[model samples]
Target: MTSLWQARSHLFNDRTAGDYHRRLAEGLRRVRDRISRVDRPFTGITPTQLAARIGRVDLDRPLGGAAAALDELEELYLRDAVYFHHPRYLAHLNCPVAIPALLGELLLSSINSSLDTWDQSAGATFIERRLIAWTAARIGFGRGADGVFTSGGTQSNLQALLLAREEAAHVSEPRVLTGAAGHFSVQKAAKLLGLGPESVVVVETGGDRRMRTDALAAELERYGGAVIAVVATAGTTDFGTIDPLPEIADQCALSGVRLHVDAAYGCGLLVSPTRRHLLDGIERADSVTVDYHKSFFQPVSCSALITRKGGDLRHSAFHADYLNPARVAAHLPDQVNKSIQTTRRFDALKLWLTLRIMGADAVGLLFDEVVERASQTWELLADDPRFEVAARSALSTVVFRFLPDEPELADQANRYARKALSASGAAVIAGTRVDGREFLKFTLLNPETTIEDVADVLDLIAEHAARYAALILEEPHVPA
Candidate 1:
């Protein structure tokens, strides 16, 4: 024990700088090699198989060296890990992260800055505040706008609804209005806020998957004084459809209801050179949620909840004598006052480095590329007779299903195709139920993915689906 204390090889400090540098370099090199060698998004390994491999590890014994540990990790984890950067990975909202943001991630992890207070984080507090102000300005908010970084879209939505709930404390019974296509997080947030299960009223959406202003107006009038807030989605997850923001804002204003725009997916449009007008009415929102990890190419857990009036964030504020005391709250820049979390990571640094190194336009262009790719994908699906598309998206998702010779077998065919494609590791895609029928979805967030890749995946899906349908048909019919 005395020798161990004297060595101090494990701790990160001035004395262990060399050890830290060497270990980190070894780890990075192994990751870089693995990424470069990856040819597919997944290895088709089942959960049980991976679990057995992990379970066999002897936790009591240590590798004792970085190289040996990395070698073990490569086989146990890196060899079968899903590579989101692969062009064939057309799955969820995950994006191929930016290199600059990776650098920020490295620096922040090493420094280990806690962003809850000024004394803990120092300059990091101001950096986060500046980024918040910059994002608010992009949303067309005035100097009174303010916000704090959050973990992701779910937390941002929760914080926004929390503020809205507190603002309507005077109302006897308050209802939250949102589109049928809005995110499920809104419902979860309502539950966490101690509201009744029926507190959230889902307004019907039109054929285009947008919340119909007429339906919204009717709901507003029906609820009348009970309606406390209207939550509008800038981008629906399944259809990638955006609600009619200008009309929704108008209705909310007239009804004296606070408007919270959940733009977690569509916030990328704020910097889109060619399509910023899609969010024209977002400036009128009382609060907005932005997820930088989704469309901005930043790493996971980088998101914010910006409010038009900075004071609205006071709902989340609670002073602790040991941390942010009430006496010095005015003088110190304590971010915990406006955040739902304490001891938050310095996530803002990732976006800060991304902006400083590559600028916002470059990130926007990457998103534009994916959006264009999705359009091309839609055209491909629309022209193909083997598939039936649900609806064209305004963003980077295309929802469609493979149609079999027998219409009744369409759902099974599509479902089998999705599972087969994923299991083969040739490609990865998402699935969802539309109108009570199964459909496959392609969320094109990787700019590197091309039309040819999508076309090849389509052919594979058709093959798998056709095989499944054929197998079913070959089964002998038994008399009931």
Candidate 2:
């Protein structure tokens, strides 16, 4: 029993501090080696192949040491992992995290602090509150503004809608109105809130992919007093287009409807030296969702939901005797009361460290670089006859597709090109359907990505698309 207890030196404590230091150093070294050696965004390893490799590992048998465990992890994860840090990784909304944030991640993981209550987290709770206040101030919210960090924009949107539902409890039917191009989470939130399938009404968008204010006004009049909230998207997923916030705010104000802005993708503009005016009317939003992971170059799962009125957060509050009883609510700063999650990680540390070390302007400059690159990419696509570009984004996404001579073959060609590009592991891009037609997307979040990289990826896409089109043309045709 003494020997068995001695062998288990993995627990982190004063006695095992040396062991923890050694293990952590080894893990960081392995990760640094992998990041330095990664050449492409992906290895194109199929799910079946990787699954089989992972299945061979014996979970019951211990590797006995950190080095051996890391060796196994490299084969199972690090080696074939999608390297978002690579400049060619243009797919999705993932960003190459800031170094300061990475440093915070190390400390937060080691400390393992929970932000549920004052006693549990102490000074950590105040840090989170201070950060929330800073974000609210950037959005032009007053002293009554309050917010809580969340897992991501999805949870932020969910909580915002929950508050809106509670506020509209007097109505028999409450509807959520948003742009047709808004994030799908709004619909999901409505469903999760027990609002029926038809509770969400999508307002039509104009040629620029922004919600038409005329249509929104009409919808508001059509719904009469039943509309609960108007969700204005500051940045859309595909086009990165921002809705007409000023006009939307006007309509919502006149109709006495609560306004929620899902700026998950556009919140970076809050500190943007040049483009801050694009989100001019965002100050009028009753609630706003911001994803620091998406736009602030922080690690994953750093997001917050801010409200103009602090009391609105009570909609998600539930008291438990042992955790946070109502008797101590006024005396103690308990974060769990404002959050849907009970035991949440201290993700606020990452952003806190990021802001402390790099400052908001520095982070905004990184985003500005990417946005500039995206504009140049749009011009490249618009001038090239081989492709048809979508609306020019005010943010950092470009939606376009290869245009072949035969209109019917355009969809198949673009689809094949996206798959081939991913399979070849040259560069990564995203695909989406626009108006029932297939299209490719470039979500440029990496500041290191340049026009040269964009040009190269475009050439690769064109080559793959042309090859697919030719192959389709050569195939033997059959009469229907």
Candidate 3:
């Protein structure tokens, strides 16, 4: 009789190919079945329940075969997974990935290419460089621009800030300035770089929630030479607001401050047919971060950190003997030379394949459609008396709160409604605290998501808020 290890062998040998194909086919079928069966984005289970269910699996002994393990995964994991592809998943920056990118992911994983050095990656090195070059041109960075693929928006921002930090090493006290609405990562990056939290000065924003140029100028003047980089947000998180980039760029130029635009959320507009002009002055920045995963409809971990000057990438370079050996590093294009990561995934293939098959204009059109949908959804909310909608969206998010009859209960009502709606699993959305008040947010990333979907979610929100408000009114309150 054959032993268990012999019967179920690994991938190093010949027989594994047929077994791999069979298992992968089964997995694909299960994915299709899950997509068809699950109409909701979530399974309405609490975090504690999910943890307990998954914790029951014993790791001591093997399940004995691939089919059994896959079956177990389907029951414990896939059934409750948050499905971004679900039309009702209007929660966050998550997007429905393109089919071409998925296909590229499949190929890249099977090949298992590591993109650190030239010999290791070979054609993959050039492929990534090509994508970076193409993206730099899209931003109109011109001839001298250079960039490297990163894990996501967070990592890309960190790398951009790292470059900015190195360039300012000559200054005695280096600092960074950004708008109040900028991503939290800005502060985190500053701290990690040994600049201390105080080094990040938060400039105020206007009523529309965009960085006030006057305020930013004042801060720059106050800091003077201490401010090494002026960070401008192309797309803010809560309100989807964009700063006046052209104006900010002018200020940076006058002061000789290094400019870095965080366009992770709005990078999709780079290809937009009508909205491309919104990103004006982006090319003027010293550095920029673009997250393809967020707005390019690629899978997760697809982002790039680009610089206006190719030579600026040297700030992040350090030679490794085992990896990018000195002998060959001079001649070939080793990706690790300019990147913060080693053993990076070949994620650039996803966008390359996407562009080859679907074309850039097609992806841009999808983004345009969703942004247009957001405008229509905003009108639906603005016209309704039940909600107090925030300012018109600059991208694809609408932030608003449910208004009950009692003014004091508005915050409580909105928070309660979001929780109740999530538990029902009819639809899923995100929540945020704007100006110390709770509000519900609709982040429309799917072009297929319609205004009718927004209306349905709004109706559910109102119903839940009304029920919660009634319960609050019926309760007896004791004075503190």
Reference-based TM-score of each model = 0.97, 0.98, 0.97
Model 2 lDDT per residue over 50-163, tens place: 999999989887787778889989999998999889999999999999999999999988899999888889989999999999999999999999999999999999999999
Deviation (Å) of 248 in candidate 2? 0.6
Per-residue lDDT, model 1, residue 294, is 95
lDDT (CA) per prediction: 0.92, 0.93, 0.89
Candidate 1 lDDT over 1-480, as tens digits, reads 247874577899998999899999988998899898999999889999999999999988777777888889988999998888999998899999999999999999999999998889999999999999999999999999999999999999999999998999987778999999899999999999988889999999988889999999999999998888999999889988899999899999999999999999999998898988989999999999999999899999799999999999999988799888877677889798899999899999999999999999999899889999999999999999999998789999999999989887788888888888888999999999887889999999999998999999999999998888887788624110
Which of the numbered candidates is closest to the native, going by highest lDDT? 2
Error of 1 at 71 (Å): 1.5
RMSD of 2: 1.9
> Model 1, 425: alpha-carbon shift in Å?
0.6
Flag clash pairs in model 2. none
lDDT of 1 at 369: 93
Off by over 4 Å in 1: 1-3, 476-480
Q: Where does model 3 exceed 4 Å of error?
A: 1-8, 12-14, 476-480
